[model samples]
Target: MKSEHTETPVTVLGLGRMGSALAGALLAAGHPTTVWNRTPGKADALVARGALRADTVADAVTASDLLVVCVLDHAAVTALLQPVAGQLAGRTLVNLTSGSPEQARETAAWAAGHGIAYLDGGIMTTPEGVGLPTSMILYSGSPEALAAHRGTLAVLGDPIDLGADAGLASLYDAGLLGLMWSVFGGWLHATALVGADGVAAGTFTPVALRWLTTVGGFLDRYAGQIDAGHYPGDDATIDVQLAAVEHLLHAGRERGVDGRLPEFHRELMAKAVAEGNGGDSYARLVDAFRRP
Candidate 1:
């Protein structure tokens, strides 16, 4: 006898890599999965794995109370769901498509108008990372919907409820991606800097990772300073880091490694020093990133 919780019927629309991964995770968790893709043949593998294939978007929407959509864009999502909006009403629409915060908010409005339970999502992993307990799947909009479907959604990844703002998931997604690229640029620059001295990246990376843990602690401490709008210089000040950036730039130049990434850091620190905020903690530079 299948318990009500164990037999969640989920309809996944769009068989793109991420969408397929979502359906596969659900199926592996013993959910009754129905999948549909415009190409039709895209669902072949999932169907073979015992997923039911819906021939049309309408059929897919009607097949399950929980609907997950991952497609090309918000525009593509609109094109596919608008015609079947009637069928979508009263069901949970978990949209994992990539788009701007505004787009997510617009979709949430449209869903609300139709009485559809909406959750705008940001998948914090590649398709390969799907179903991993550590991978985060951010959700915002409709707290009740998240509470109801959190279990079924956990099959995809760790479901992180981000309150009831539909736009927050997308907002955080863009910011987080920006943070990732910054870290990548810094790491790559450091790797090249050391590699210039005949040091292998593999040898340096493990040590670099440990440094990141210390940096993470810095971030945790700085977050409070930023929120309080009072960046205390009791810890290391921006002026101190500015001197360290000079050393990094000198080292990069001597080794013929590009100094652009560290140069940006130097520029920010120098600006703070010139503005007489150099005595403040490194987080004082957060003001440089904000509007006047």
Candidate 2:
């Protein structure tokens, strides 16, 4: 059934957790949502909630000019869409599959070859976070397509346009996930070290959050320093932090906590210092990560 008011008709081609969340958000926001899944059973709940269930992938693709695909991987995306490539011409295909930058670029090229308007997307939150205002959904490809469907897409989350390179969405997603893991590792390590002295996690986390805000400011400054290839030590010197890390190692040793994370940091800082960067800011360590 079509929406009487003609809300931008949309189809979601997967029924996994994240895909279901996306369809739910679109329906919740008044879109005429069509859904399809291989198992058929997966679409039952969505159908009960007023989503039109497409009997086949072709039906789903034909149901809307804007199709959102959130599938298992690049291979699965290929398998699902290749047969229907002809039907997809001139339509906007928003692929939210997780894959490498190269894969995304290749898919964009394939879409371009078929005369389809393609937009590669990265969902920046868990299934539970979908549709929340704070969640960011990154999109890159076919700026014209995004400009046209942005309002409809915003129902899924904040649509962050990363410009026309379809691969940039995947690249940014991978880097962002890496940043998340690094933050998690550092937070867990600190929690364990503090817990050793009987500090409750709940008590320590608020302070840690405030500290992270301050650290975020440092990152803002350091990003520019890195781009300029001139890391100033006006705020704090790598040599000073090098001396401070010894205390952390000592504390971790006394508490029987794992010291590998801090040890790695110490190694990086020491190398920078050895290379005559001791007077530079910690941002100089960015060079340590790069190959000559």
Candidate 3:
């Protein structure tokens, strides 16, 4: 039988940077937390802050109806919890480990097989962002389980219920990271280009930040068009964009700036155009990713 929560006591597994932040947030929110880390010494700070240090994984999971696991990966989480599967029969397992969508779905199935209600999560914020309303944590899994611990989960961050599809959180996490890398890649290239003219990154930081903020609105507008498969060149066509990219490539080469970054953009734009999308919006290039 599953254990019933009478006082909202919570269990935290893994005491890494993110895990410690989560446990600290819970303690600050006045929830009695039971903590267990593979390395016994890692729980010292939480122990000093009134969290009960569990001697074993079983004991930790047994201590609370809501068990939060934030390990390194799916394999580590599986190994750590395999020994305590029996104890998790009725417990709600919220996994905040970063992994692929397939891993999340497989773990969800394993949890269901053990009669555990599972929720997969992706923390979009850093450790310092925990407990703040702005800290967005995407979650997907059993609705009932989420509803049961919504209050407790909110103590860590904003609990966004994506859906019953356990893989959604991880999918969103991967997609967000791809977007982040794209932005970062552009920034690094821009900084390098300006640095060639003896301009420090600090001097160009505000300009880059302002431009990124303004361009962010394109994501929302393009999302609709991308989903609908409508590649209308309402704002800018791929051909026009490709022309601009060519000028960038030429300028980077002339200025002796590393042309690798701009070359990549030029190649992508050229490929999209060659694929008969020259008249379409730049957003239409996203389809190329699905070609495989």
Candidate 4:
């Protein structure tokens, strides 16, 4: 019996870590993958794994109807593709580079001008996570193109279709990064605090992670309050939260932990309460963040 899968010709422009992983995943999934990179050497591993190495960007674009560009940034992607825009006509280009929402919109407009269907994507997984089912990728762009190449794209994991708006993928990426940074910052603060008690990070990590799971529920509740713009002090008011934050700051100082982070929270809450938001929900601090 014939195989159910249909092979698609995919061109991966930029053979950096992420780019190489993408091409390798395509090749592994039995697609014909064409790879091109400025350095040339970066394509060797993919070539060995059955990828066709393109000598020029134009050659890469012309070799495949579905092109995946995972360059350093929007500027690099633009610089590389601008010179070979003619060859990209009648093709679908999926850009997985990290960039601002404005950049994704601009690139979509440019691709449209060249008669190319554009899909802006954001990969949340590391290079090793490519092709794994656990990997998540945010995508927003031409629906027709996505439907046409969804199977080929699914090789990288679940391709989450946000919407037809090209900017949504980048916006999602930015929000996800903000969450990641907040978690990382909290982890660092917690680790340092435990260090003062002669505790190793390895010993404290599991406990901290358990606490994170508990706090995750709080985030779900806070999300509803934030979206509704309802600053109800049913749970805890700004004054009460500020009192707890001050206590945290005091403990941090006493233990010689990093005072800067806890102090910043305490100060922010203090200002919010002083500005007559003492009875408001902690989420009301979103207003302070918006202030200059």
Order of quality (lDDT): 2, 1, 3, 4
Give the candidate number with the greatest lDDT: 2
Candidate 3 local Cα displacement, residue 184, angstroms:
0.9
What lDDT tens digits, residue by residue, belong to model 1 across residues 1-292?
5453567899999999999999999888889999999999999999999999998899999999999999999999999999999999999999999999999999999999999999999999999999999999999999999999898899899998899999999999999999999999999999999999888999999999999999999999999999999988998999899998989999999999988889888888899999999999999989889943
Residue 103, model 1: lDDT of 99
lDDT of each: 0.94, 0.95, 0.91, 0.90
lDDT of 4 by residue, 126-226 (tens): 99999998899889999999899898899997899998999999999999999899889989998988888889999999999899998888788888888
Point out where model 4 deviates above 4 Å. 1-5
Q: Report the Cα lDDT for candidate 1.
A: 0.94
lDDT of 2 by residue, 12-103 (tens): 99999999999999988878899998889999998998999999999999999999999899999999999999999989999998999999
